[model samples]
Target: MPCVLTPDPTAQETPARPTSTSTSLRDRSSAMLREHLRPTIQFLLVGGVVFLLDTAMYNLLVFWSPSHGWGTGLMHGTPLTAKVLTIAVASCLTYLGNRLWTFGDRPRPGTTRSIMLFILVNLIAAGLQLSCLGFSRYVLGLDSVLADNISGTLIGQVVSTSFRYVTYGRLVFPKH
Candidate 1:
């Protein structure tokens, strides 16, 4: 005990290290991606339902009406008429789905206001689809049923759905 001294055990213990920058950055990136993707995923899920309803209604009105001899005059098995009716019905379904699921967490507006805004957004989207159909049927002279589906249902829907998703998120269900 004359000269030798023992080291304090506490002095040798190291403090816990803070998270590395790389780790923190990675975590932040992952969190941001998840936050962004969640709404998009929800929208697509709702859209799938809307699309099924829309396609089914469209086919029924266009093909079934002719066979069943249901419609008359302008309401008959015209592509425009079928599209209008199917899209109207689909828009209603879309509104319900988006309100209940897609933007459910956002603050809900008054029912009337919400519906009006939703309808307005859909009108713009519908216009886009209609334009595609008109161009294909009239301008491009590709009036076949296949052409109508390609131009209006496939191409136009892709574009309009993108526009609708952005507008609905920003305008209809804005963050507070």
Candidate 2:
């Protein structure tokens, strides 16, 4: 028979026992998954804010490009450069905000590397986005500024988000 004997009501109260797999590997992994989710949500929220800013800037640039005499040129320089510049600036702001708040607990490899690596990843993605945007702008005759921004912004972010998540998951957050 199973031992079911001793009530100790008169003795000092004992702590409640952990009835689940709280001390097991599955529980540990589940906890890690839970922790990772918060950062993922933060990345999305933060990235969304940055995406809005990029779209607004793209539209603004297109709107004023003619007046400032910069939009008429080809992809190598002119408006292409402007688009990249604007995205870079916005990314700079994002990095700061994300490092301090969003992925604050993540293990970034110090300021300089973190800044360079993060921006490098973003810029590479930006380049892809801009390339597509430029194509849409000139080749596809997507003359409308809003349409161009929407396509480039959405497409570029989706592509970059894949790589960015890898970086954030492995490098930024580490196994902590």
C-alpha TM-scores of all predictions: 0.76, 0.68
Clashing pairs in 2: none
User: How do the residues 48-140 of candidate 2 rate in per-residue lDDT, one tens digit apiece?
Assistant: 888788766765665554446544323323556667877887778777767877778766556676666776777676777777777877788
Best by TM-score: 1
Where does the lowest 10-residue lDDT sum fall in candidate 1? 68-77
Residue 70, candidate 2: C-alpha displacement in angstroms:
16
In order, candidate lDDTs are 0.79, 0.70
Worst window of 10 by summed lDDT in candidate 2: 69-78
The pairs that clash in candidate 1 are none
Off by over 4 Å in 1: 1-28, 65-77
Q: Name the best candidate (by lDDT).
A: 1
Candidate 1 per-residue lDDT, tens place, 30-130, comes to 99998779889989988888887876676555545454553332333367777878889888888888888888998875767778888899999999988
Clashes of each: 0, 0
